[model samples]
Target chain A: MEKLKYALFTGCTAKQSTPEQMMSTMAVANKLGIELVELTEASCCGASHLQDYDDFLSLVLNARNIAYAEKHGLTMVTICNTCQLNTAMTKHRLDNNEELKAKVNEKLAEVGLEYKGTSPVTHFLYAIIDDFGLDKLKEMVVTPLSQFNIAPFYGCHNIRPSELQNETHKSAENPYNPTSLDDLIIACGGMNVDYDEKNKCCGFHAELQSPHTAAALTGNAIAGAMDNNADWMVTPCPLCHLKLDTQADHASEAIGREVELPVLHMQQMVGLALGCTPAELGLKHHVTKVDFV
Target chain B: MSTEHKITTQNVNFKVFRFNADEDYLPYYEDYNMEVTSEEVVLDILNRIKWDHDGSFSYRRSCRHGICGACAIKVNGRSTLACKESMNDMIDLFGNELTIEPLSKKRAIKDMIIDKADFWDKHAAVQPYLVAEIDEAPTSENLVSPEEENALDDADLCIQCGACHYACPAVEHNEDFFGPAAFAAAYRFSADVRDHSETRLADVNEEKQGVWDCVKCFECAEACPKEINPIGKITKLHQMAFQEGIAKNNVAVRHAVGFKKSIVKNGVLDEGGLVLYSEGPAIVKHIPVALKMFSKGKIVPPWGITKSENLDEIKKLVKSSSTAKF
Candidate 1:
């Protein structure tokens, strides 16, 4: 709470492509007096890619990411859902097993790194919700979003498997019943409307192999949100952002309708509340319009 | 004794997935608005549609309660049992408009009915029944201790509802993946203390069609109607498989383990080394996919030659970890 400092582990998806997510996350965190230290030289969290090869290697890759945070003596905060899940699972695995920790430490030792097992992988959504309390967040809101009926899309990985639940997250709540993003929406004076497919997958991961199937999946979510008359939608995952925003053209084609629905990242939504302009929040760089935000 | 207000419905509508194998047409959504029932289940609304709206509208439902798991369908794209989910809860979350479909990852036979053959097949492959682990039969009724029962208590609640199977991304992509319900069912018997695990463990290690295929999406655990936590069962299966030494040189394991090795050696994924090491002979078959990824700029060059900043640390991390070299 006291000027929280976290090594921001902007995973490959956000770091390479979705700079707005990282930039706005930093901007919002800084506004709350939190320092966003960069977690660098870390490998990918192995989302679905590394998991295919070896489960142990996925843990190692995750551990290496956490190790970067540990090296700097800080907690690792991330905006990517897959990265958060992979890192949190690795942390849970290593935390419970001393033997595995020693083994991982031994491998880490060769590269002059040691898995001290200190840092925790925190998703930026929970990071903001927990550290920057809803009360404080509401106080910081310069622009109220009551006019926009926003749907909070809490994609798949960031909220479940129980093992990833930390101090800020609770698996006790139904995974299908996502209300975390609603807090942010309400904090910014937005109507956090319910859409049928609020918890449905964006099919981003599905897109790489089968574009058609992925498009259909994204189209379904967009249609669901539109059916509920949502002015716009906000999501925590950058992958979901890509599917909801960039692929709307294809999604529209798949569903046989004009799916020109706008999507914004959680941070970008927060940036709007804190009166950050389009350029400041990297809204101009997005595939979608800044009509709502 | 109590001054209470009357329960009422506010223009509730049902969007049921309508399909008829007898009819030569694609599936479509047929909407029906129902009159007052304050505490009605989705099944009740479907029954209303059958009785009042149209007699031809067909669906399956054995129990009005949640036990039978017969009314499993996609309520707003999530596999849910209509009998179990309440209208009040639905209204609270998603308002009066409900979109129902025969569960995804399945074939809709008619209306909300889906072909359960593959589900039953996968469930059966896990060998859901149980017998003594050893050859000798128990002299009396094989009674499990309270603690043991407590360990497997959650598993007992499984109603064989294929909700998790439909909810799983793994099952959507890979038809043969044992799936969430099957894994949970398998775990129930495996943890029974009386069931032989050798065959069951072998079943779990099936190429990519088993536990390895699960991307840990956790949608299974989320969509589970009975709070069975099927994802937990799959994780338990992973541990048990490791313990049994029931291993295979599969794509998932090879990719997962080798990805770490590549990162430890090079800062990031050793692209060339990964395909050569993990895929081995199968690398040639995947060249087109790799080229597509390459053109998209997803995979960059310098291959495995790129060195990371913390070379020493990556090496120690890889070398020190207790990884099984298959």
Candidate 2:
């Protein structure tokens, strides 16, 4: 049993919007006997703006972060899918595009930074599943959440664009493709149900651009969970949590039902079943309240 | 279940992801070798499997008419509504060994239904509904002439199914990008004669998420279930936004504006000057980006390029084209 460690890249949301997920992830890592070193000086993963609005700006921004991680001699583990995609795409681009790399390296030299493109990035779930085997997870489960019927939401980044994580992880592209999240959930003594709309977007962009669409999309997930008689919904992405938990009021109105579905970050749920307290798992920050032991 | 429906049947194998109440949640695919008909939709097949074969195989489908967009799933590698896609299509393609799953880029809800409401926020953010200004009572249903009303008829048919958005290369890179549906819907409002174009453009231009993010991949056009050409609408909106000076944040706008300057001054696009002018001092940023290109000798200097001699004709074209709103 080899202990796994990660250069944890929590990004902005874990620091600002959904601190609970970060806490839960850390708790789960501890329970699984995994070591995590936080990247403290890491600034914003450039968020989603630079990629959409400015191409060159996005390249420079992501290049800086990748160079930082490479210098540290550790693979980066991102909590946010957007951050994962940006950093991963930058690494992909840097590896493929030599001229771009040289120019970026020239600028990096100005700032005392050089990107050698050595570090590989992984999502938190990848570390949990591949590094912390199912055997270890089953041992850590203190309470089986058998009373709960849950739907798993993959969001967008966990799957899709095999280029993000590389060809070896292409099997993860299909949302239906099984992952350790489901195994951990069921192992914790919780019931995992087949849900409709489990892979739908939470309208994270809608939060900034259009509240109505965000409400409708988030509402659809809530409604789908309610329809399936799910006590709560579980997702690995914190951005999805923000939209799913915060948009309950709007989702409730659209579905014409009290769709008060609480969304638990997968790490939070895993932590709870591992006998971690609500405070330890940071459950208080979630917009939807969860009854935890 | 409808009495008016005439059902037919065929033996097929469905590798369904099953969940056990007491057992561990291992998603083993069970081959429910069953019979299905040509007229029967995928949703119908699932209903049969749940009722007779497996009681716990849960999924979602409603309105069956394709209007609600609830039954979307992947039949082969392509996304389609379960209610709308006929089993005949599958029999024709993959035959009995059909691997049905929820849509890609979403969480699998169950057998074949995926949570597709994410596009709703994108639609709402783009302000999907019609917004018109009519102080006086319109004599006839907003009184749109056939020509003005039909201007964006191609853009109006988006069902918001989200296949195009998921398939797009640009959307994969840019999270803030509103993707095809938002821009298509934006054009829907922008093209309306009664809608306040200035106000609408203001809203469209306010964010990085608007039409500016489109890389003109045209993948959305291919994925559109409806005949609507979303890429065309995006192009139209780009022209409108550029001409109105509302599409200022767009990287493409830098190219457009610089090209306009070239046409006006040198009678055609001065290719070398165009890049320098469009990027300005920001061209310094390219030093880092172009290093690999420089190493490969692909980085061409932004100078000594021949300029277009048809600058006057291009200016005339821009001037003459300004009157017609795309």
Best by lDDT: 1
Top candidate, metric DockQ: 1
lDDT of 1 by residue, B268-312 (tens): 555556657766786776565455434433344444243656666
Q: Write the per-residue lDDT of candidate 2 for residues A95-162, one digit (tens) a residue.
A: 89999899767666655667788878878776666666666777778877888897777776555443
- In terms of docking quality, model 1 is acceptable
Each prediction's TM-score against the native? 0.68, 0.57
Worst 10 residues of 2 chain B by lDDT: B317-326
Restricting to chain A, the TM-score for each candidate equals: 0.94, 0.92
Model 2 misplaced stretches (Cα beyond 4 Å): A162-171, A176-180, A254-256, B1-245, B248-326
Q: Tell me the tens digit of each residue's lDDT in model 1 across A123-198.
A: 8888787666789889888988878999888887776754356433632335656678988899999999787678
Summarize candidate 2's per-residue lDDT along B162-212 as a digit string, tens digits. 767665544654566777777788888888776764566656555466665
